[model samples]
Target: MSILASSFHEGPLLDKYNNLLISHERYRAMFDNIPLAYMSMNENAAIIDFNNAFSELTGYSCEEVYMKPFSFFLYDKKDIEYHVNVTFPRFKRNGFARNQPWKLKHKSGREIYVIVHGNVRYDTDGRFIQTHCLIVDVTEQRLAREECQRAESKAQLILDVISERVTFHDREHHVLWANKNARSNAAPEC
Candidate 1:
């Protein structure tokens, strides 16, 4: 007999129990070790559990966040209002929210931009249980985009100030942008 068969004379009952234990362990390992931040909140939106990555991302210990409202970390009043009025209601209705961006306040008072995915959980009886959320820190990505936009705006300003007529066109031969001189010098379409 195989070791598992020999060890468990209780047959399928013990096998099922063992399988459940193994599955639970695997899920716990994944939940704790995944690089992205993960958290679960109670039906009232209070934090119930979170992973080490979440603690590190928000700079708050698990103890500090536990039992606190999820909105406690929102950086702005308007954001809090939006979450309460818009996001939560939509999540409740749809049971899932994907890749929605929000700003959270880090413990050190820095704003952390994150893209969040949330799913509402229900009991076997269809009663609401809690919400599970995955948070990906996108602060660096957002800042980089802002910097690029600023650079483009500065370049456009330089182009506009020059005396030369400059126009930018897409591959389809449609004008995307034109410097001030180019716009002023262009003939009216017949």
Candidate 2:
């Protein structure tokens, strides 16, 4: 028998209930499928739930991490210090945090750099309940940026050693950068 036919008779109430069920199902599907990592932690910072992406990122299954102190994942001393001294205090006061960078220890014992966006939840009685976090892995981006800076520094070193004066300019001929040699060898103003 069709679900509509089987479930307590068809009526406006049934239709409304069906629509709400469908909407909830759709929301669950999207939450599970989205690439971004999402997690919720209870007031004490214990893990409540996390999406698939978060599980993959942390290398910890929901079953393994559920109700565990989320702070246990933070292994780096610098990251821990910053989180405790700066991030947590700020978040507590503001009830939200954004673009907060921290490192988490993966299940494989490697550090994973992440940026977190979070919101705190409170009960009507002014009690803390849970906080939601949207985390993004930025390890690759940080490495690429460091690599780029190194390459630029190496190029600059080479440019500085050369005999020719090298000055970078904008389209309007405004000077943006000058190599060390360029600066030293620049002609004095008339």
Best by TM-score: 1
Error of 1 at 116 (Å): 1.1
Writing each residue's lDDT as its tens digit, candidate 2 over 27-90 gives 9899988999998887667789788998898898778878877677897877667776777767
- For candidate 1, the per-residue lDDT at 169 reads 93
lDDT of each: 0.91, 0.85
Poorest lDDT segment (10 consecutive residues) of candidate 1: 4-13
* Candidate 1 segments whose C-alpha is farther than 4 A from its true place: 1-19
lDDT, candidate 1, 38-145, per-residue tens:
998887778899998999999998789899887999999999999888988788778899999889999999999999998999889877788899999999999999
TM-scores of all candidate predictions against the true structure: 0.87, 0.79
